[model samples]
Target: EEWMALRIGPVVNLPINHLAELSSKLDPDFPVVAVCNSAYRSSLAVGILQRQGFQNVASLAGGSQAWIDAGLPVYGTETQATVSAAPQRHVHLAERISAADLSRLMQDLPGTFDLVDIRPPQAFAEYALPGSRNAEIADLLSNPGYLTGAGPLVIVDRDGSLAMMIAGILSQKTQRPIKALQGGLD
Candidate 1:
């Protein structure tokens, strides 16, 4: 029999991919302790948070596994509802559209599809392709019904990772044709 992984304690679980939303959700000076099964992603998260102007941030030296190994307090039960707060990895393969193809499609068939840009509002305001609409990942995931459009929905991001993950999740949840921009807008 396999056992589910347990959380260390009551911690604000945030996915590293959605760090863009952190600024809006957390104060820049809020103390943050990033943790994971291993310390690799935690360290990365700490660096990203620091770059985003987060004043006090740190990563667990060896992560939750280490904490468990040290016999630290933990709380969870099989009956406890599993939290789906963290973004799931792209299990379903999402279709990718090359930039050239996307450009051609935009020019050749206007209104045929919706280009949803999932980048931060500031970045989108700074620069975005024509005919693209800004959207939050949370909205896209929660209210997928709004995705109804003429054709396939194309997701765009700064580096395509989040877009790919979103596309995969959406593909599993909706009947709409989904695609992520290959290599992102970077």
Candidate 2:
């Protein structure tokens, strides 16, 4: 079934909410295997699918690592699959920046860039970079109006991961450049 292939349901980009929507469209009776670079995301995907009533959802244990280790033939294609579900424009910053870089950015505070705090409202109210706007990462989709107007956007979270997540979503929705604070507020 190499070319015929196991009809994998949805290979979500990075957003967890998209996984939930994809799960709803899947054939519940058919087996679905969630895969990612590693098992972490796939496991999370499985959990999401399960909660959404996907009974036969399974995560590829050990993910692509186990498949490569087992000598399973991997498919490679230059052509990208166009997922209508994917947001039109989004920049993903997978690498973390340094504290020094963050300090310099803050000191300079680029005029065209808007600093957004992606942490919880409580955390942001307690302490955050001065003048940073609050927008919880989890509520980005629910509140589409969070980011308004046009400008480069910077997201600050308690940690780099949450910032990255919010950055991806904002990048998609706003079609604007989104950056994450290198070390967050730490």
Provide the overall lDDT of each model, using Cα atoms, as 2-decimal numbers: 0.84, 0.68
CA lDDT, candidate 1, residue 14: 79
Q: What TM-score does prediction 2 earn? A: 0.45
Q: Which candidate should be chosen as best, given lDDT against the real structure? A: 1
Candidate 1, residue 57: how far the Cα is off, in Å: 48
Give RMSD to native, each candidate: 17.8, 14.3
Task: Estimate the TM-score of every prediction.
Answer: 0.50, 0.45
Model 1: residues >4 Å from true position, as ranges? 1-93
Q: What TM-score does model 1 achieve against the real structure?
A: 0.50
Residue pairs in candidate 2 whose N, alpha carbon or C atoms collide under 3 angstroms: none
The weakest ten consecutive residues by lDDT in model 1 span 1-10
Question: Residue 59 deviation, candidate 1, in Å?
Answer: 38
The list of candidate 2 runs beyond 4 A from truth reads 1-97, 142-150
RMSD of 2: 14.3
